[model samples]
Target: MGIRTKLKRNRTQKKGMPPGSLVYIGDEQTEEVTVSAIAFDSHGMEEFEDVSIDKIKTLIDSDQVAWINVNGVHNVQLVDQISKKLGLHPLTTEDILNTDHRPKIDFFEDHLLSIVKMLDLSAESTDLDIEQVSFILMENTVVTFQEKRGDLFDPVRLQLQESKGRIRKSGADFLYYSLLDVIFDQYLIIMDEMDDRIAELEGMIMEDPDNHSLQDINQYKNTILQLKKTVWPVREVVNKLINRKVPYIKEDISFYLQDIHDHIVQANDMVETSRGQLYGLLDVYYSSLSMKMNEIMKVLTIVSTIFIPLTFIAGIYGMNFTNMPELSWDWSYPAVWIVMIIITGLMLVYFKRKNWF
Candidate 1:
């Protein structure tokens, strides 16, 4: 899912680059940025592919609703130009370039900016993958940037194109909410995947505890911890948005943000639940080891009990030959064998009655 961290500042660009240059926030070998402009209103929708910054500028003035989606963050100049055209703050642009930002909301004089993480589970390995997505909401337009070319926003795009919901009639803030909702939905999917894995590990531990299962549980526990680190901050960010009266955010959209807040709470709850399950699994593993030790001890104790009487008879016979009468008896060897068998049998019976096995 194109997981990325904060990019190093490109100090080398100082040779000719402007002071507020848009420094790419990720891997430099990224593909060219792909821009798609979707202009929609109550009446209809129009989509423009591979649109240039000039075209975007022209569309920004249109009364129809517009969404500009940029697929890559590698072209600093283009991003800088867009920021200038939209009157976005330089700090906001810098945050956009700093990919390590936690989920947050910033209220600018003319717009609202949101930073969020998108999660995906690796298909080959059950690893949780994440990417950073930044949203800039203006009067009638919403601009979104991603660290990579692929995303989970296809469903939202389809909805907008089909005019399937209130998205078409709503302002850019609603559109922002829709995008956030999709990202949160992806979070839920990730949580479900983790939950399924936790359940599977539980079954495996219960059936037979082993080192492999312990490692698997620990790996998943670490993944859950990482997810919690990303999501818990998101809850606080959303809470801040919900509590404050932001100018760009519409009052009607507060309820939607509240819903997102509730989802964050649920995500936090799932993390806690997964943590408890991991602890339980560790306890079960230890208990299994203890039980195995007890079984081995039981067998050794039984063998010692059976040999005790036999050892006593042998000790008596080994005394000075002149004093040992049984050693000279004609049937002495057979009598010793019989006595040993009787003692072993009685011990076995006692053990069976006591249900030690």
Candidate 2:
């Protein structure tokens, strides 16, 4: 379904409900919710393909840092169950279920909640694939909730598996930073794609500006607007994280979050640049239309001006008066033909000199 229709239906479903109500406000899905976890510390790492509530509680209470990933959030009962077990706030659960929530950070007493939009450009086209991803960070555990199964976090997972860099030795906060970093990296990729698309549109506009170009420009404008909306708030979220807004985030993790902050700022700049270019392209398209119109009008005016004198000459000679002198001359027809030819040639030369066509 289209986003607008889904939003309208989402509102209708939640109209009379109280705040913090858990309502699944996204596309309809019947896939069962699946939970997977990876727990690691300096000693060793463990993977859980299917984790239960007891397993989660055990990992959270133990010394090892745990990362629990939930694939689907459409199951309200499953979400509430996990949230209650993890001591997540009611509003956090509500936001998780409401996939339309903006990218933001919510601080609670026990855990910190972060909601971010994950976007990817489809391989087949420039259209974006977007989903809401929510994170709940606690002392030694980070829980992630997604609308569906696939995501861009595979790189982060690979790092954890290979014991690469400082991820294995760091706390849950560092892992959280790694995930956010992955999201921002995708943003950079998207920026590149946007640049390529703008260049393509620019070339099309310059070569052959048509109604299709206008329509494509408009569609891309909306796409870039959505990108801006998703990216702009993420910068604020990263800033808040860097400013020590969340207690769970440690001092060392702040430095890494700064990198994400820089990346997001760069993404924001790219978004703004794309927006300006799209506006300029729109102006070019309009100017092209106007120039075409002016060419047509100029040609019609020149043709009419040349025909005026020829028509007047013909009218004068074809008068019904019997005293017309040209009618009695034997060479009148040839003389008139030569005069008309000379007038046509002179008019053509004059127009050529004026560069009217």
Candidate 3:
């Protein structure tokens, strides 16, 4: 669905309803909600795929770091049950189901909540894909919810399997930080792709600017706009993670979170730079178009200027006056032809000297 339409629908659904009520506000894609769990420590990791809600609830404990991933939030009952089991506040679950929320960080007594937009490029086309990902970081467990099954978290899972980096030895808050790192990495990926496309567009428009070029410029401009809107809130979320001084997060992870915040700032800078370049592209396209039009108009005006005096000469000879001396002479036709040629040549020379073409 279009962004505006989806937002409008979500707002309409919440009207007159009690605050914190469970209402799925995103596109519903699954026949059944899917839940999965993973528990890991410094030693090893174990995964439970498509596990039942009851099983997932049991997986949350103090022994190891547990990552509970809920793929679909359309099932309100399932989400409510999970929230109740996890001791999450009503507003927390409410935000999880409401996928239209802006990127935000909410800290409660027991858990911290983070909401952010994850971006992806569709493999089939240039279309951009945006998904709302929510995270709840507790003492020994982390709960995540997505609009659908596919996500950018696979790399983190691979790291967990291979025991790469410090992730194998961290707590739930560290795991949360790692996941946010991956999300910001995806933003960089998107930024690189867009930068490449913009460079290609610059070359194309420079070589030949036309309607098609203008349309492509507009398309990239819109994509940059989407990037700007999506990334603006992320700075707030990351800044909160660093400055809010949540008690559960270890101080060591602050450096890591700061790096993520810097990456987010870099991504935002790229977006702003791309936006300015796109605006310059529009100016270039207009200048090229105007140049082409002036060339055409110059040629037409020169042709008309050459024809004016020739037409006047012809008009004088065609008159029916009885005292017309030139019409009776045998050399009149050749003389008139020579005069017209002279006028045409003179005008051509003048146009060339004026550099009208």
In order, the Cα lDDT scores of the candidates are: 0.81, 0.89, 0.87
lDDT, model 2: 0.89
What's the TM-score of every candidate structure?
0.84, 0.89, 0.90
Write candidate 2's Cα lDDT for 203-234 as tens digits.
Answer: 88877788999888988898899899899999
Q: By TM-score, how accurate is candidate 2?
A: 0.89
Worst 10-residue stretch by lDDT in candidate 3? 53-62
Stronger candidate by TM-score (1 vs 2): 2
User: Per-residue lDDT of 1-357 in model 3, one digit per residue for the tens?
Assistant: 565687678779889999897788876465667888889999999998887767766677548889999888888898899988888889999999988788898988888889999899755445788899999998889999988878899999999999998898999888999889988999999888888888888888777788899888888888888888899889988998898776779899899999999999999999998899999989888887888788788878888888889999888887879998887899989999998998898888877898875
Over all chains combined, what TM-score does candidate 1 have? 0.84
Clashing residue pairs in candidate 1, if any?
Answer: none
| Per-residue lDDT over 1-357 for candidate 1, one digit per residue giving the tens place of the 0 to 100 score | 233332434534434865555665555554787898899888888999998878888878888878998887667777777877778888788778756777888887777888988888886665766678989888888999887788988988898888888998887888888889889877877888778878887888777777887788788878888898888889888888788786767899999999988898988888888888888878887788678778889999999888988899878877767877777789999998898899899999999999987
lDDT of 3 at 102: 85
RMSD of each: 3.9, 2.6, 2.5
Record all residue pairs in model 2 with backbone atoms less than 3 Å apart, i.e. clashing: none
Per TM-score, the best of the predicted structures is: 3
Query: What TM-score does candidate 3 get on C-alpha atoms?
Result: 0.90
